[model samples]
Target: MRALTGHPLRPVTEMSPQRVLLVNLACMGAPALLIIQGVLQHGKVDWFAAGLGCITLFALVALRMFDLVSQVHDKARQLDAVAHIDALTALPNRRAWDLELSRRIAAARRHGSPVVVAILDLDHFKKYNDEHGHQGGDNLLSSAAAAWRGQLRPEDLLARYGGEEFGAIFDQSKLADADRIIERLQAVNPLGQTFSAGAAQWNGSETAEELLARADVALYAAKAAGRNRVYVSSIR
Candidate 1:
């Protein structure tokens, strides 16, 4: 709705409880005026109108209460999103990756499905920062994340592990598929830059920590051998 000045009215979610109370108080004024009129006019009272006015006041109060509840739910939704998101890359942050890993590992163990965990590191990333500055580095990460995520399945999760590093978890995937996906991510251009990835297929016997640790070791080897390639760990 537009206000009298032709500006769009603020959404109820943006309104504070105090503002809602003020609006409800304004609505109550009309009914309250009628009730006061009834009481002051000598002995004969309009019982029906008085009851209706009371109902109106009660309804306004109820609506304000519902609005307050909606605001609470809105806050929770926003907090949940903020907690999981990486501000720079718009990818899931490390905390979100950890939570997802734990949940998916439990399910994989129950169903005997293989899961793949990989760590991705930007190749010569520090050199890029030295040449282009921090903002440039952040842009590179964001570009890389968007490009990689566009190719991912809905169920696949990619997260920012830390500076110049990323994490990915693929459900029901074998080592071969993980290798292919990692290669694809390497090919995605982060401003004509490249990355190195180390992928491991979970053996169903190791914890999530072990899986990530093994992937990290493989990543180290990838950097050791040469950068801009994927190294697969057959940990199973």
Candidate 2:
């Protein structure tokens, strides 16, 4: 209904108009020709011709049906992707981040691996927005998101947690590894701006929410100490 979210202006159907016409022609034209042939042959039914026509009709119908099903499946997948993505930056949004954190925590507990969570806030983001227009701020944010996303490992997750803030989940990583990755993200970002981050490796007994809260506390500490640094939570 919404043109499959990001894919706007796409044709209503995945199949082209010409292809649709071709399918319809094969479905109807072959049967009509066979019937005409039977009539011309003194109504003695051209069994061979009719059989071929029937097969062609069924095959065309099956092809069209499969294409429709595939289109539906693709559309559904696009919708799901849209739901989890930030419209501006095309990065995973807060909802996706939350789910990923829970998933990673569960997996880490099972495998006796570490799950590191971090919260990053752009330094003096308000000043940047005030100096540059909203559009400029948005461009900066998107660029930063892209750059940070590139720094993540296959086992890591980076998501926009709303307005100038991002969340990261490092599966099978400890606090030290998280710090290194965050430093890397800050270093590579094209915005030429710094961010303050707070991170904590998941403790065996804590929930994802508790883990995030600890990271948040550490993040605020980083802001209090200096603008461009990372603080690791000391609580377990």
Candidate 3:
């Protein structure tokens, strides 16, 4: 329609309020010429009517165009938010936690500070599901995630690692710090439950996966030792 009317069409991204003004001015150019010609060459169109019609059309088009742009911006923000959030627990997901861990580890290595990784598994979670049903277990896990989230610092990263398992990355801390965190988590009961956790400190050379694996081993040891305590890796 714009091309047929002798107005140049630009791509949507190239559009701006100034460009919209230029396009409207360009459209008005034709009607202004036509109105002048009608006065000089005898009436073919009315000058006042043509100018008013052109201004009104331009106003409506510009309004619609800006409305569409605002909608696109809002949708982009919504998608970015969904990417970082875990739908089930409403906590940070694994990907978000990995990014946090990377930043913390970089700062710790530079400043000779400690960062701790703790991997948590619900004690006898499979047996709990078998005895209490899957829905009951899910309610417990959700309650547990909420409990741990409350214990975290603003810089801490807590995520659902998998079925009956969760993890955290704590900045400026050691493996021993997990004892207090574990105690806080165990004190409350939606189902009279407890967690087994393994913790290990970042050693400068270890990747996040390696750190998590060491924590997992400690978690196994804690589970073996009794199912309600925190264990620092004996190897590290």
Q: Give the winner by TM-score.
A: 1
Q: Which digits, one per residue and each the tens of the lDDT, describe model 2 over residues 1-236?
A: 14345454324565679987987787787668767877788767767777887887798788867977776777777878788988998878999898888887888888888788899999998899999989889988989988888888988878899899999888878888888899898898776788999999888879998998999999999999977999999757
lDDT, candidate 1, at 14: 56
TM-score, cand. 3 vs. native: 0.74
Candidate 1 per-residue lDDT, tens place, 68-135, comes to 78766666666677788888887888998999999999999999998999999999999999899998
User: TM-score of every model?
Assistant: 0.82, 0.77, 0.74
Better of 1 and 3 by TM-score: 1
Tell me the tens digit of each residue's lDDT in model 3 across 135-173.
888888889888887877777778877788888887887
Model 1 alpha-carbon drift over 4 Å, by segment = 1-45
| Model 2, residue 140: C-alpha shift (Å) | 1.9
Q: Which ten residues in a row have the lowest lDDT in candidate 2?
A: 1-10
**The 10-residue segment with the lowest total lDDT in model 1:** 1-10
